[model samples]
Target: MEKDLAPKYLIHKDEKLYFAFAVIVSIIGYLFLIVSIVGFIVWLGFAILSMFLYGLMMAQIRVNGIRLSDKQFPEVFEKVRELCERMEIRVVPDIYVIESGGALNAFASRFFRKNMVVLYSDVFDLINSADDGELSFIIAHELAHIKRNHISKQLFILPAMWIPFLSEAYSRGCEYTCDRMAAYYTNNAEASMNGLTMLGIGKSLFKKVNRREYLLQSSQEKGFFPWLAEKISTHPPLPKRIDEIQMFVGDSSSSAFRRTSRAMWLVVGIVLVIFTFAGIGFLYSDEIEEAVNSIVLDANSITNDVSSDEDSTIMVQAVAEGDIAKVKEQLESGIDPDIQDADGWTPLMWAAQDNNVDLIQLFIEAGADLELQDYYEETALMKAASQDHVEAIALLIEAGADPNMASESYGWTPLMTAATSGNLEAARMLLEAGANPKSKDGDNFTAFLHAKKEGYKEIADLIKQYEDNVN
Candidate 1:
């Protein structure tokens, strides 16, 4: 940990803080697990199996991909060897240059003890053509990840790996550390910045981009969605990484990392997914088969589970759970389609939540009341229209559902609900189905006004068109 391969001045200041926090939480979690020996043994077994399967998958990937060797792609191979020598790494990772469907990216991977580097063909082309050591910076960046043992340490801190912002912050800090070392290795700061900029914009556009204005614009962009997206991401965003590279080159000790771009955990993810489904299928074979069979909407399976007593409970429950077969069976056994629960919500109302067209048709054919209101005084059409369920709205309207039916709370009619929610298709369906666009909600806002207030310009425009045609 004390050995410095890169200059001490370039390393990120907060990398140690975030790593230490995760380590502390991991230690606390492990100490509590010490009390439950059986549970610990089960977890240990599962971890071992996952590692074994994922290691095999990585080995297969290395064999299948085009490997860079002494005879082919020798320049890239030499860079790997050179970086390992400079970083004091004991092993030189095998580098593979593979075509990634025009993806301009690269990744560092390790399985068991063998490390591998994957370079997309386009990134290799871009880096190979550059003269200012951008290729060296990219190779050195991945090498720094190996030198720091970022991948291996995740096992010990497994408990804290999925804890919301904590692990993601640790990962972003690791990325900053990598960027600093890479910038230090290249020596030419602007070239290293260009290498990162190439990742954000494509290969053809990096030279023309004004870095200062780009950074300023990205910094000024603010909202809850952007903040939440970065908080949940594993790597710092490309612009943030570029800013950190600038700080590193200037020997500034401050941190400027935030947000994320592409993900890097893709190497082992495919193997884990394959083994997860395989393990689950093997463990629950019978239950899985039964569940699959129960959902077959054939006439034979749908009419099988008839009850002797005429009870509405099973039919209502089946409709709520989306078990179409069970619902049909209950209906065939003489249960009422308009059966209400304690809250006066019918089977049709429960089915409306998912906007199931088949279920709605069955209730309509059974002579269920289309205008029936729940405890909240909302019709099935009101529920469907607000969600922009166009197919459901069309079917309900064709079956004579009241398009103008209003719910109790805001007295929001189906058309007003669709407009307020910015559901353009649902609003159009309601309008075409003869819903009155001029009708007002409890707040005295018409559907047109509702669309305008909610910033739905297209919906407001459509409402205006309908009003103009009427005039």
Candidate 2:
């Protein structure tokens, strides 16, 4: 079984398809050789020429102009190298750091003879400073691409890309396979998942994001609309990728088997469609080419409506204003709710401060993980109560907000927040929902003492009731 999974540096499934395409083209050339009555040697030359051209078509990179040296960024390169070694894979690809602060990206580029991994300088900086396992997981994920021959297969799919729908399906399958490979290289699921989160889904306070809750949220998007959207996508939606990582971090073989099965079915479907169209193409090859070209040209004219950056800013504003409709629009537009602005305030944090109960509910309904804390270690519940938002407090409490949760930096809880604010209604709701009245704040004052000192007699009464209930 281990041998079966033994990494092959050669052609992968997609690469095999490329070679099939090459063979098909070569067979057609040989048939021409028979019809033209050419000399045996000339006929052989044409066949060889067809084979060479086919292979060259799959080779997307022709020159190696970029150099990847570990010496350029010794610290990051050393860490990445160590991580690759830990994964037990041979042939670690060269690492190149490029100038891209605005665009955070990492990709396997193999246009030249040498296989390479190019990481944006900002991306390296963001991830390199992370905790121990995070750096390793990220590096391991990139190496998984090299070990699995993903780049080679990607190059092989160029011909199929002419078929718009099939090309989309093939590209998506490749992403899932690479995601599985990343999980395989890092035995730690949290590390692998967190790495992806930092790349796209997480913020600075990523440590508090509940992995289970995020996975559950992703699982709810497998409906017909989601499926149709996925069919037209280049990358599997971020949540689906997270869901895929969660399913396979501990067990690569299982993940690989499941992915392979799904890929096999997709490939079978594509092959059937190709055969159905191939006969048509053979009968009227010129007309088919013209039609395919027209479709491709029209596709190129379509404008991309991706609004990740604009949507992020709008989401922050909507949260600040407690605008449920605008927030929902941004979420559906693919803006990540957990993203923070220059001040490090997530959308949830902004909504909590705005004291908008309906907007907060909208975020929760859109699958925003409520457990995620801001950079200050303040959860949404804590934020709402801190600002004396009674309705927001009630909504958060009903949604399973942990009243006892304390910020590591500030060491404050919801009860302490309500006590300091002197909001009797908020205090009563929190206490009734199991807020620990005995919990102390940064000043080491219990909720009861905080309320009394703030001259809030009604707030103090609520704290006393909670204390009395427990006693």
Please report the candidate that would top lDDT against the real structure.
Answer: 1
Reference-based TM-score of each model: 0.51, 0.41
lDDT of each: 0.72, 0.61
Candidate 1 off by > 4 Å: 1-9, 251-471
lDDT of 2 by residue, 104-217 (tens): 566765433345676666556664465646655656656766655555444333344544445555566566666655555555566766766766644365677775666556
Q: For residues 391-471, write the lDDT of model 1, one tens digit per residue.
A: 888888899898877776777788887888899999999999888878777878899998899999999999988877764
Residue pairs with backbone overlap in model 2: 61-111
**How good is model 2 by TM-score?**
0.41
